[model samples]
Target: MKLAVIGAGAVGSSVVELASDHGHSVTAFADSSSAVIDSAGVDTAAVLDRKRTDGVVGGGAPEDALSAEYDVLVEATPTTLGDAEPGFGHIQAALERDRHAVLANKGPVAERYADVRALERESEGSVLFEATVGGAMPILSTIDDFDPSHITAVRGVLNGTANFILSRMATEGLDYEHVLAEAQDLGVAEADPTFDVDGTDAALKGVIIANVLSDDETEYTLDDAEVTGIQEISGSALELARADGRTVRLIAEVVEGSVRVGPRLVPDNAPLAVSGTRNIAQLETEHAGQLNISGRGAGGPETASAVLADIGRL
Candidate 1:
């Protein structure tokens, strides 16, 4: 597939760098302000080098890549709530042109599921977003394979930043602020760290999962989720949980048309009590009993791999 990638961030750049390895060509690439286009294929290395050195993907307007030659639009833009602008609009442009849309951005699917599906219904293209829920984890694809009806519920640690902090606190008896500072220094947590630490990122993933499981019977948005952050989780709480043979994880649970994300207690030996920056998702199934899927849940190359897998599906 020929891919047009928007957003020159880590995930976008990874997709551009790895597209050829996945048997796809990125025909156009864009950042927030600029773009590079070619009917044949964009020079991936040159474009990425320019982005590294000059801080822009190319010289053209960002919107130009939306109209460039491509079989699929890889929407890797920064995720936004509410309107989910630019990302939603980019998906709209692709579907309007009858081109497939493979998303790494969770905004459109999480916040505007019905709108995206409505557009897909009228277009010849289909939308797949395996990268949105768990980076490189194949969470959505597995759910689709099992058939959403067969899956009873989905719950686990969906945010690596929050999980790392909790894990460090529980294991080392470090305070919340200290562990968070270590995480930020280690690049596990962002400078702001609001979304990942505040449960918004995990909630967005839960909302997307809920939207998928709904199968169009219901539409889910951030407003529908009950979100609780880990900001107030002190080391003493983790100590208490540890004394009880349990650990705290920022779990996102989606079941029976509801989505909830917050810190939850899990047994120390439980699969959900994964350490460091790893992520785990437990799927309750009707026939299969329980299924555990775990791996690196966030990173550029990790997420880009998922995005490329979605493109291959398209």
Candidate 2:
């Protein structure tokens, strides 16, 4: 497949870098301001290096990549809330032309899933967003394989930054501010981690899961999710939970038509209690019982792998 990748951030750059390894070629690549489009594949190495040095993918206009020839549009733009614009518009362009779209952006699917599906229903194109929920963990595909109907509920530690802060607080007997500072220094948490630590990121993933499980009878957005962050957690609270042989994690629960993400106590030995930067999704199946999928949930190549996998499925 030939891919037109938008958004020159970590995930998009990774997709451009690794696409060739997966037996796919990138015909077009773009950041916010520029793009490089070629019918015959673009030079991935030069483009990436130029981006590193110059901070732009190519000299061409970003819109050029949208109209460029490609089998699939890899929408890896940063996840935006509300209307999910630019990214949503990009996906709409691909589907309007009857071309496939594979997403690493959570905005379009998390906020406008029903609209995306409605567009897909009217076009020859199809949309797949395995990277939107869990990076490299195959959560969405697992749900699809089992048939969403067969999966009773989904819950897990979906945010790595929040998990890292919480787990470090419990293990090191540190306060929330201290652990959060360490996490930021280590690049485990972003400079502005409001979304990650405030449970918005986990809620977006939960909302995506809910949208999937609803199967079109219902449509969910972030507004529908009940969210809580780990900002107010204190050292004493961690010590208390530790004394009780339990740990707190930011758990996202999608069950019985509701999506909730908040800090919750779990047994230290439980699978949901995974530590530092690791993520786990536990699925309750109707007959097959519980299934746990765990791995690095956020990173460039880790997430790009899921994006390319979706292209393969396409």
State model 2's lDDT: 0.94
lDDT of each: 0.94, 0.94
* Poorest stretch of ten by lDDT in candidate 2: 232-241
Model 2 per-residue lDDT tens digits across residues 177-217 = 99889999998989999999999999999999999999799
Please list the residue runs of candidate 1 whose C-alpha ends up more than 4 Å from where it truly belongs after superposition: none
Residue pairs with backbone overlap in model 1: none
What would the per-residue lDDT of candidate 1 be over residues 106-217, giving only the tens digit for each residue?
Answer: 9999999999999999999999999998799989999999999999999988888999999999999999899999999999999999999899999999999999898799
lDDT of 1: 0.94
Against the true structure, candidate 1 reaches a TM-score of 0.99
Provide the TM-score for each candidate, comma-separated.
0.99, 0.99
